[model samples]
Target chain A: MSLAVQPIDDSETINPEAVRRDFPIFSGSTQPRRFHYLDHAATTPKPSAVINSISDCYAQCYAPIHRGLYPMAEQATSNYEHARRTLQHFIGAASPDELVFTRSATEAINMVASGWLKPRLERGDVVWVSRMEHHSNYLPWQLVCQEQQAQLRFIELTEDGQLDLDGTPELFAERTKFIAITHVSNVLGTENPVATLCTTAREYGIPVLVDAAQSVSHIELDVAEMCCDFLAFSAHKMFGPTGIGLLYGRQERLAEMAPLQVGGGMVDSVGDGMEESRWAAIPARFEAGSPDMPGAVGFAAAADYLSSLGHERVHRHIVSLTRLAAQRLMRIDGIRLLPHAGLPASGIVSFTHHNMHPHDMAQIAGEAGVAIRAGHHCAQPLLRRLGLTATARASFSVYNDESDIDALIDAIISAQRVFCE
Target chain B: MIAQDLYKETLLEHYRHPKNRCDGPIQDADAVERGANPRCGDEIEIGIFLQDENIRHVQFRGRGCAICIASASMLTEAVAGLSVAGTRILCEQMHDWFGDIEPAAGALLPNGLQALAAVRQHPARQKCVLLSWEALADAIDKAGRE
Candidate 1:
C-alpha cells in the first residue's frame, strides 16, 4: 500500500500514495480490485478537486456567461474570466488575450489550420511536421496544405526515436512557411526540443505551433520561452474535465488570423449585409457559441493541481517509472521496446512482443487489472515508419509507482504463457 | 480468470498452428479479400480457390490477435469442400453467433467453433473474431462476380 517512488537522483521522488488520495478512482471503495492504470497517455483520471469544482459551479452559481446582466450571471461570467486567467498564468502566456477556449485540442488545431494557415499559404509553399505527431496535429496541416496547393514535409526521426534536428537551419528553405510539432510524442514519450525548433524557425520567418496535449501534464510550458506562435492542449489529458481545450496564440498572430466561427458573443455589431458585421476583439472573436462554463472552472482547478505539484517532481517521477518499465520489459524473452529505450522520455514506454499480438497482450493485461493502450495510437504514419502495426504501451502518471510496472510485467508474462507456451 | 476462459487450450492450439495459413502473395488464389480493424490495427486477408462452384481451398494471411487467427483457422476447416451456398450460410451463422443472437434450433456452429462462444462476451474482440469471416464472404463475392 506504500506507493513511494524511488528517487532518480538526489532529488525527492513523488509519494504516489499521497497523490492517489487526491484522485477518487484509486481510493478505497471506488476500485475494489487491485487495479493498476498505465494508460495516462490516453487520459488521466480526474482528481477530486477538479470534480468538486465542476459540481460546485453548477450547484451554486450556474448561468450563461457573457450574456446575462443579472447578479448570478455576472458572478458566473467573472468566474469564467478568472478561469481564463488561471490558464493564461499556467502556461505563462504574456496576456489573457492570447488564450481561446475550444472544444478539444483537435478542434484547436483545426482552427489554426483553417483560420490562420489556409489564407496565408501560397501554392508550392511548404509546411513541416515531425513524423511523431498525433493525427490531430498531422491531419490539419495535411488538409490545409492540400487545399492551398502547398506541400507538407515530414521531419524524420533518428533510429532512437528522437527527432532528427541535425542541420536544423538547412532543413528550412524559403518555401518553408510553417512548422507544427509535438512537445512530446504520445506513443514514444520522446520529449521533442520544441524550443530549439522554434528558435531555428524564427530566423527563417517561419512560425511554429507546438501541440502540447501530451506534454502539458508532464512538462512545464512557457509559450514565451518556447517562442511558438501557437500552442494547443486538452484539459482532460491533465486530470481536468473533458469538453474544454485551450488554444494559446500570440497576440499579433491571432490578430492576423480570421475567426473559425461567427455569431453570438463573438460579434460586436451586426448589419443586414454579411460584410457589414463587426467582430469582437481577439480571443472572443475565436470563441463563438456558448462555452462549457463548468468545464472552464474544472480546467482551472486542474491547472492549479499541476502547479501545486511542481513539474520537476512530476517529471522525475514519471521518467523514473518509465525507465524502470522499459528496462524490465526488455528483459522479457520476446519483448522489443522503442529506443532510446524510453530513458529520459516523458512517461510512455511502448513495446512489441515477437510472438504475441498487441490486442492479445492488452487483453491479458486488462484481465489482470493492468490497463494499458494497445494499437496504432492514432499515429499510423509514425507506426508505419517504425515498421509496426501496433504496440502495447504502458504510460505512467503521478499516482503510479513501481508496483504498476510489476503488474505490467506480470501481465506480459501471462500473455506469453497463453500465446507462446 | 477471463483470460483462461477466453484463450482456452483448443483456441490456443488453433492460434499456435493455424490451418491453411499462407505467407507472401498467393499467386494461384481465385479470389482474395482483406479486412482491417482500424481501431486495433488487426488485418486479415482471405484467399479462396474455387472449383465447380464450390470452395476447393481456403487460406488466410495477416497479423492479428489470437482470437482472430483461431477464428480464421476454424472457418477454413469448417468451409473445406463446401458449396458457395453452404459457406454463405456458415458466414450468416457466425454473424448471428458473434452478435450474441441465438440461432435457430439445431443450426449449431460446426468445427468446434462453439468453444469460441466466450469471445462474444468481449465486444471489442468480436471484430477480431469476425474479421476473417467477413473477408471470406467478400472473397466469395469477388469470385462470383468474376
Candidate 2:
C-alpha cells in the first residue's frame, strides 16, 4: 500500500477560530495558559452538527416513533430507521437487520452475555480472550463463565503491544468456542490485526467478537471484510451522543440469537401467560422499550460530521499527535513511556515518572492546565499485570492540535522541575 | 507567601538534607515498623527508641516521592521530645495544618512542622506526607496491641 502524505498548510486544513466557535463549552473555559486536551480515548467532544441534530429532533419531532400514528411520529420513525441504515453503510454491513441498538458498549456486551452466546454455550467450552482487552470485554466473560461453569483463556501480548501470534498454539483446538479481543488498546494505543485474528479464528471454526470501542473512531473499519461475527462500540467515544451504542452481528447469527431483555416494542404479540409471548424478528428482538431516538439522530449526525472531515484525515492527524506526544514524554528525565507508542498508537500515551505517583502527576498537570487521565483507567487487570496501581495517560483526538502536545510536554517538565528542585 | 511557605522551606531542607533518616542500631532500638503505600509503591520503616513506657527518640528510613521522605524526616524532628499523646496530637494538628493552607501560601509549612506544607497545595500528596506517620501510628497501635 502506497502511504499518502497530505500537505500541512494547517490553515486550509483546519480553521482554529471556526473550530473553537463550534463548541459552546470552549467559549466559557478560561483557555488557561494553554488548555491541552489529551483524553480523547476516554470520550470525544461532539461538534455543532451533532449538537444541533439532537436539539432539532427535540424541538420539532419529540414523540414515540414506531408505535405512534401521528405526523411527528412518522418523521421520527423515518429518521431513526435511516440512522440504522447510515451506520450499516458506515461499517459496511450487508443489511440494517443486523444492527442492534443498546445503551452503551458495556450493556451491549451484557446482552451478548445473556442473549446470543450464553444459552448455546455449555460448561467446559473454552472462550479465548486477549490480555489487552478492556474491562468491558474481559469482565463479561468472567461473570458468564462463573455462572455457566465455562472456561476463559487469555492470549498474550508482545512487548510492542501487538498480539503474540506465535505464542497461541492452543487456538487450534476443538474446545475453543470463540475469541474475544479488542481492536485497539485504550491504555497502550496498540492496534490489533483484526482481519488476521478473525481469519485465524475461522480455521478452528470459532467465531470472533471484537470490542471495537477504541478502533471505531481511529481507524477505518469494514466488518464484512474483517469477517467477524459480532462487533460492539459506543458513539460517545466517537464524537457522538452518550446513552447510545451499536451492536453489529451478522444477519444469520442475529436471526437465531435469543433476546436478553423482553418488553414493549420487542414483542409481536403476548398471551395472558408471560412466557407465551412472541418476540419481534432480528434487530427488534434485542431492542426493548422506547429507543433513544433523539440520541440516535445526533449519533447519525456525528457519523456524517466525522465522514465529512474524512476518517482517513482524522486518522492521520491523531497518529501524528500520538507520535509527537510519545516522543516528547519519553525524553523527560525519570519518565518511562509504555510500549507501542507511535504514529498510529491507540491514540493514548501512557507513562510513569520514576518516583512520582500518577495521581500526583495528574494533579500537577491539572494545575498546569494540561488535562491527563490518572490511576488504573479501569484496566486493573492490565495494571496488575504491569505491577502498577496507577499510571498517567494523555490521549489525543481530532480537535487537539500540535500545540496541545507541546503544552503537555512543557507542563510535565515544569512539574518535574517544581517538585524535584 | 502564606506562613505555610515556612513549611515548604522545611520540607525542601529535610528532603535535601534529611535528618533522622536512617534506622537506629538494633542495640539502641525496641522494635521496627514497616509500612508501604501500595498505590505509589512507597515503603517506610520506623525505628523508635523508647525508655520504659515513654518515647525517647524516633527516626525513619524510606524510599519514595520527595514529599513522603521529607515528611518522614520532619515528623521525626517534631515528635522527638514528645510523648505518645503529644505525637498523636501533632499528627492530627499536621493534618489540620495541611487542610488549612492555600496553594499561594507557598510551598513551605508555616510553623515548625513546615516541611509538610507542600502537601497542603497538593491534596493528592497528603497520603505521601502521611505515610510514615501512618506507619508510626500503626507501630504504636501494634505495640499497644501486643
Clashes of each: 0, 15
State the lDDT of candidate 2 residue by residue for A303-395, as single tens digits: 776666667767777777788888878888989877676444657889988756676577667766778987677677777777676788998
Poorly placed runs, candidate 2 (over 4 Å): A1-21, A29-33, A273-275, A342-346, B1-144
Residue A191, model 2: lDDT of 85
Tens digit per residue, CA lDDT, model 2, B1-146: 22234235566567667788774432455657877876666778887776667668887887766677787887777677777776666555565555563433333332556545546666666777878877787766666665
Question: What digit string (tens of lDDT, one per residue) describes model 1 on residues A1-421?
Answer: 0012223344467788888888888866866786899999999999998999999999999999999999999999989998998888888899999999999999999999999999999999999999999999999999999999999988989989899987354467898998999999989989998998898888778899999999999898899999899999999999999889999999999999899999889999998866688899989999999878999999998888887777889988899889999999989999999766547478999999999999899999999999999999999889999988889898899889888989999999988888887
Off by over 4 Å in 1: A1-11, A28-30, A167-170, B99-107
TM-score of each: 0.95, 0.82
Best by lDDT: 1
